[model samples]
Target: MADWLSPAEWDALRLSLRVSFWATLVSLPFGLLVAHALARWRFPGHGLLNGLVHLPLVLPPVVTGYLLLLTFGRRGWVGQWLDQWFGIVFAFRWTGAVLAAAIMAFPLMVRAIRLSVEAVDPRLEQAAGTLGASGPWVWATVTLPLILPGVIAGAVLAFAKAMGEFGATITFVSNIPGQTQTLPSAIYSFLQVPGGEAPAARLVVISVVVAMSALVASEWLARRAMRRVQGR
Candidate 1:
């Protein structure tokens, strides 16, 4: 594998893994919070919040990327503030790629987690509360344990989705080599050049393997977590 790929290709592959890992890791906590809110909360604008959370799934990836660029571009509002105050800039950077991947992957992660949260028995949480457990404690000890399988599934799903993210990332970061060129972007770039099919094909195989492995791992982890919860 090392000999088959050029240094540039290897850089893209490594960067893709880094971007996907960060995207999944950074988004997991927010995904869990949003999933829990949608599953259990009945606050105002619930439907609106849910719709907003899922909008990326329905919207065109290009459009989502454009919106991200508009909001996070150097001259943009949030982008300017971050650059001025925090010395942070997302435009055309690897961090921008992470943001795009996370945004594109968010819906899948949230959906899987929401389903898992919904499947948990509410009575278990209520019983824990009756035993004098605080709300947070009950959630931490009982509700979270019951939904651990789903959470694992959701994280794996998000990670896989991030691995394949292209459109938004390209639009946001412009596919710079060794900087923001993820697997999909690298594959696309290779396709645009002469005699690039072989490299593209190699990356395609890697992408398929990574995606399938993630799915399999998700299933295995979920089952393990379920068994743990059942004390079996």
Candidate 2:
């Protein structure tokens, strides 16, 4: 392992974790909102919103990345406004990497959350409302607890997806070593070089380990949450 990976490997590993965490955290609320909308609402644009949310699942990662660049690039519309107003730039920054990962992983998160939400008993919500709980209060106290397992599962899925994300991240953020070169991107770079094969292999192993650990943690959390909800 030492022969394969250098300090740069450690940096990439840490950055991947940071990016994945931020991506998952930032997207969770939105995922839950979308999941609730899909479960309980039937507005006119509902289908469109659902389709848009799942577009990343079917669209090529490169295409998604290009779209992000077009919309969030320095010269791009939203990108220009953000840069001018907030001094926030994502074109080639670590923030951009997080955005790309979040976008790509959003569908998985939404799907998991929506399934969980749909499985919830609306009758229980109605009872809570009848008992003087407001809609938001019922959701906060009742619905959320029931869906906690799914939320955890979705977050884990998103985190895993973010960790392995490469095409969208590279296109949106470009591959800047130590800044934006995540584990997958670093592996790609190593594979392109002659003596970099061993390092690439090491990174791949690390990625697998990280992904496995995340899965195990998520499963454990989901089970624990399920037990708690049941106990309640």
Candidate 3:
């Protein structure tokens, strides 16, 4: 793979994988919580929450990035407080790229998981509760297993989305070479200069391969999840 992609290209690819992995991992717990809430609960502000969750999909990537920058940048309020108290910085850094990718991929993950959650029968959980299982235990042993396929599918989709993320990442962290440059950013960078089409094409191929692999993996996992659900 190193020989296949140039050093810079390899860097971008590596960074993209790293960012996507961390982003997906970090988003999982939150995704599950939000998905369950959206799927099973009906609060007073349910519509508002749903709209807010899907807001990023309708908004331009640049606008989302700008908002992230304004809210999470070094000089931003949250950023300053974090920096002062926790020493965690997110502006123009790799972590910021992860945040951007996570946020960009979140809605898709939530939607997939929400659909799965909706498919589950509430009676199973109620039965578990009647059997003296705590809510969390019931969720862990019952609800979670039933929706494993959707969770896997959602996670893989988020990974693919994170891999392709460009606009928000670039806007939030800028193209700072190995520090913050992702696969899409590298491809964009390649396209900006003369005699860069070949490299850009190569990166595009890489992107397609990675995305396809994620999809294939998702399908396989979904099937496996079904098998488990069936006790096969």
**lDDT agreement with native, every candidate:** 0.93, 0.94, 0.95
Task: List the candidate 2 regions with Cα displacement exceeding 4 Å.
Answer: 1-4
Residue pairs that clash (backbone atoms under 3 angstroms), model 2: none
Considering summed lDDT, which 10 consecutive residues are worst modelled in model 2?
Answer: 1-10
Q: Which is the winner by lDDT between candidate 1 and candidate 3?
A: 3
Candidate 2 lDDT, tens digit per residue, 1-232?
A: 5544688888898899999999999999999999999988999999999999999999999999999999999999999999999999999999999999999999999999999999999999999999999988998999999999999999999999999999899988998899999999999999999999888988999999989999999999999999998895
Question: Could you give me the TM-score of model 2 versus the true structure?
Answer: 0.96
Model 3: which ten-residue window has the lowest total lDDT? 1-10
Query: How many residue-pair clashes does candidate 3 contain?
Result: 0
Put down candidate 3 lDDT per residue, 1-232, tens digits, no spaces: 3587789998999999999999999999999999999998989999898898898788999999999999999998999999999999999899999999999999999999999999999999999999999999999999999999999999999999999998899999999899999999999999999999999999999999999999999999999998999789
Judged by TM-score relative to the true structure, which candidate is superior, 1 or 2?
1
lDDT of 2: 0.94
Using all chains and alpha carbons, the TM-scores for the candidates as numbered come to 0.97, 0.96, 0.97
